[model samples]
Target: MPPSLRVSQRRLRPGSRVAIVSPSFGAPGLFPHVHDLAMQRLQSELQLIPVEYSTTRQVGATPRERAADLNAAFSDASIEAIMATIGGDDQITVLPFLDSDMIAKNPKPFFGYSDNTNLLNYLWNLGISSYHGGSTMAHVARPGGLHPLSTSSLCAALFSGGDFELYPVSEFSEDEQNWNDAAWSDPNGPPPSPLQTSAGWHWHQPDRVITGPSWGGNLEILDWNLAANRWIRNNPADYSGCVLLLETSEEMPSAAYVFRTLRNAGERGLLAQFPAVLIARPKASNIEIQPTPEQRMQYRQEQREAILKAFAYYNPDTMIVFDVDFGHTDPQWILPYGGMITVNGPQRQIIAHFG
Candidate 1:
């Protein structure tokens, strides 16, 4: 597709009636208390109405219903934007049920990450822009108050247009405060964990500012897309001039797996096409498999090495930034997929231009 044809032009505004749909999982609606809080925050903080759909709370609903909810949100003139309730493990299932025409025509902002990467990449394939951050249940309406950085970045993504810089949050949190906890019911729970002072963004190949349309999402979820051959362009060159932002989920795939995935991308000629890659900080802990500090550091090191090796093999000149705050980590930065991104590696700065 031509560059102009692949871009969506709508920009979100305040007072937009945003639809909250569960395209993947319905955790929010299943726990109405948390979902309701998210809705409340959307209204009070953003001055946006949150419209919920049937599938938003309906666990085990067919992908058809989820697709219908997406269609409804886009088709509704009143709904200026759409946000996912949370990510799931099977968003790929919803692909067949989607109405590409509706999504292409409406072209409003859609916000999600992780499994929602399925929909984001799908929209990108349809030549529509989308956001890769902020879900109702996970980030916006956490048990404790939302992270300041997450909230700030989300607001900027929803309301602002044009070039916007993303800074490292002074403090960050990755604590998985459970939704089942009564504290979630309280709009304000115990104070969020103190953010450790930021060490600032790390840059590699810091030479010049590379600007391009943004692409990529939860790294593990994207592998599913590769398997299905669903949303990616057939030609690797189709991704040329794009800035790829990737992150791992809470599942924390083994470092070997990360390297292997990158190796596969390199083999496919995908790694060499992008001008830059912004890798989000990997989630280091999970309920089932918590790693010690040493183990976590080792994991990060291995993954980093794997990424470097793949880049060296495929695109040695590509710019890269490690540990950007997006994806499964707290203080997530909202990124606009298919929208413009500026990576000023020489200046150690990143700007996501959305409108």
Candidate 2:
């Protein structure tokens, strides 16, 4: 591991307090019932207390206001950790307002994904490790209770500190409930989107093993960061030996867009820095964009090919794993950003170290 990268050893006990802040869109404000359910689960399921901030449910809060909430969370001694209510597109705007020095001095495990990738990468550049997964509103407040796999991996990331082996789930779904529909708040509301059987993980160049700190997040967000040259290291070698964590969002970007985004990274001399990459199962169908089953399968295939094409151009020797359940996918695994991950290609296994 690089000396610059720092992993927190602080683990949450049952009674610890976790601050829930909305550093992005205030989804909690829009769906307080779902957000309340998530808060309740934080106590009933995890046996931990959830503390919300001023902007936690404040829709249309400015970027500075969001940053203020985050800063407060970091500075508060009683708060052992911080978790976002949900992710939004404008989190990048909040980045410049963050108090990096203060956050670096008071590092804690941050848990959120999608647009939260902006904050995750910010913390990474400061050498602080965080968890990459969906927000409380999106995951914990899931209509049909939490997915067993999500709970299993989240527990590992939150309370346990060890090498937890990543597992392949039998079934998964990308469907989301319409929050505006009152049924979503009903106990007997419609069941979650139909579950599809997983084909399991696909491995490429499984001839060697690579263990390193994981980086990267939603592909689109990474592209945004790259375009802005925000917190990314100027010298790509700073990422040498790191495992790249890649995933798409609910937007369902085309294979061409995925290829171009990665191509941009490769053009920046970025892709060659990593020896291994873990691509999350792309979210094929969403509430807005519903495609046929065959189309969904075809989408994933073309996406995989696009990724391989990018790697083939920049780093052909890279070990690649596709459809690891993380990011936008349900039954997701919470990966440690900037923490150690072992990509055992020959063993066809992955182990994430939640330090």
Candidate 3:
């Protein structure tokens, strides 16, 4: 394996300065209350200073404008790391304007997921590793407080570069509180969305261990990137031995769509490159479509089946673990993008190697 496949040893120390830019969406502009609280936590809890760019709070900022913020952040020597405020749908548009040469010359740890996957893959292709799950507005400014799991994993990713074992959440939530609602601005903030008892992770073909650099994110965004055929390596073999990380966004794509997306990758001979796969707990419900508890279970089961079918057809020997919390789900775990991840099938465990 190439040495650049893993993240560099660079890490943020206490009092480090991090650039908080909205490379995807100017969410801080949309909800200043949520953004402000997140900034406060970034300082008080993490003991890091937050630096915002011009486009950080400018709603409807152009793709070039967003890309410029990212370029500026990466070029700035004082900024130890860069983090996105939130993910949005149009991040793909910003890719064309990014100054890859400038970014490659001055690499910094980036943190975000969902649409941020586009940037993550771009960085990965450049041999720069990033965090796959984080959003200043979503996690740091979470109502009530940050999830213990999120705080721990994020802290590990940011400061401690070591092997970190992932634990399943016994209870989790996928519902979202309306950020536009007045409750978000209240002194107490809005109550946390209810959590459902986790069914625990389900492992398939737990016969061996597979450890390699991580790849893939938000399945939907990956499909878009795959179709663009720009960021992904031209040869599928470039991904051989990598662990696949997949999760669905709040858009809640249907089982058929998920199957088709994976199937597309399979047809391209890309899916077979991964020896192991870690799937995030699917977001079973959204604010618009709240399924009953029973229905939610059914939905998850169907999606699981779709995934198994696709992988079974493409690579029967591949190991799969379902329902690991990350991405759109509550209490997200910050996994390393392009960093080492060990999927131990026999032990039924997942460990992320930070840095």
Candidate 4:
């Protein structure tokens, strides 16, 4: 890791330019209204100007073109930061075309998650820290303005550089909000569905505090990395002392599938490398699935057990916390990928350093 990477971390002043690129699915091209809403909020709330690249709104762009757009954003002297518009299923395909040397030479904060995990991991491997949340369409363009939790956390990551504690939102919604219709564009949209009271963090091996640089991303994406033989370290020992960040996508793979994925990681000697693990709240259901409440509860419980089963078999002494709201959940926190993270088990808390 180069000390120069930290030199790349700069707090953006209001009206500073941020590059908006779609390295994943080009949802922004399909829903221009949604993209416009997000751009408006970035300008009005953050006072930042969004400069869209050619491939940003290009739905059928080749991987090379999107990778070229990313290269352009990182290398540009005027662009202070980079943000993904949304996550897609095939972002893994874009990894090979990225220039690791160029990205490392011109490191800057990158913000995104889900399928954008591919990009986050790519930056992490280059020894550059990035943000693991805040896709423009899903978060910045959220109904009824930005959610308070997401806004506050994102602001801290963008404007300041230090240790920030992460906490549970008092309530979070899994509302059946439709994004394509006019209902989504209305600032005075109908009230969000009732928020479920948080169950709070569930812990295992809550004893010592472990602090280190963070690693890991979406579980499905990590699995893809392993299968593709890309990005993942050849030596498991390379991950020692790092905090692992894991989350599921809306596809909502079955508990058995999640277990199998983790089990494969463990078998590959990956799970034992980290002393702390953060699992995002499993998106128990989606509009396509529309599971019953009882079914949702059972699904989450089973998934939790599956994760615990994997850890127990591999790294039993690790500090594990479940249901973190950073992935596929409402009011997401923007975690700093490859940045310092403190997991205080005895105190039951997690702190991350954006710088």
TM-score of each: 0.95, 0.97, 0.97, 0.96
Minimal lDDT window, size 10, model 2: 183-192
lDDT of 4: 0.85
RMSD in Å for model 1: 1.8
Misplaced by over 4 Å in model 3 are 1-3, 6-8
What are the per-residue Cα lDDT tens digits for candidate 2 across 138-242? 888877887778888889888887889997888988887787777766643347778999999999999898989999999999989988888888888889999
Residue lDDT tens for model 3, 146-204: 77899999999989879999988898888888988888777546888997898889999
List the pairs of residues colliding in candidate 1. 171-195
Q: What lDDT score goes with residue 275 in model 3? A: 92
lDDT score of model 3? 0.89
lDDT of each: 0.81, 0.89, 0.89, 0.85
Deviating ranges (above 4 Å) for candidate 4: 1-7, 188-190
User: After superposition on all CA atoms, what RMSD does each candidate show versus the true structure?
Assistant: 1.8, 1.3, 1.3, 1.7
Model 2 residue 249 CA deviation in Å? 0.6
Candidate 2 root-mean-square deviation in Å: 1.3
Better model by lDDT: candidate 1 vs candidate 3: 3
Error of 2 at 120 (Å): 0.4
Model 1: lowest-lDDT 10 consecutive positions: 1-10
**All candidates in order of lDDT, best leading:** 3, 2, 4, 1
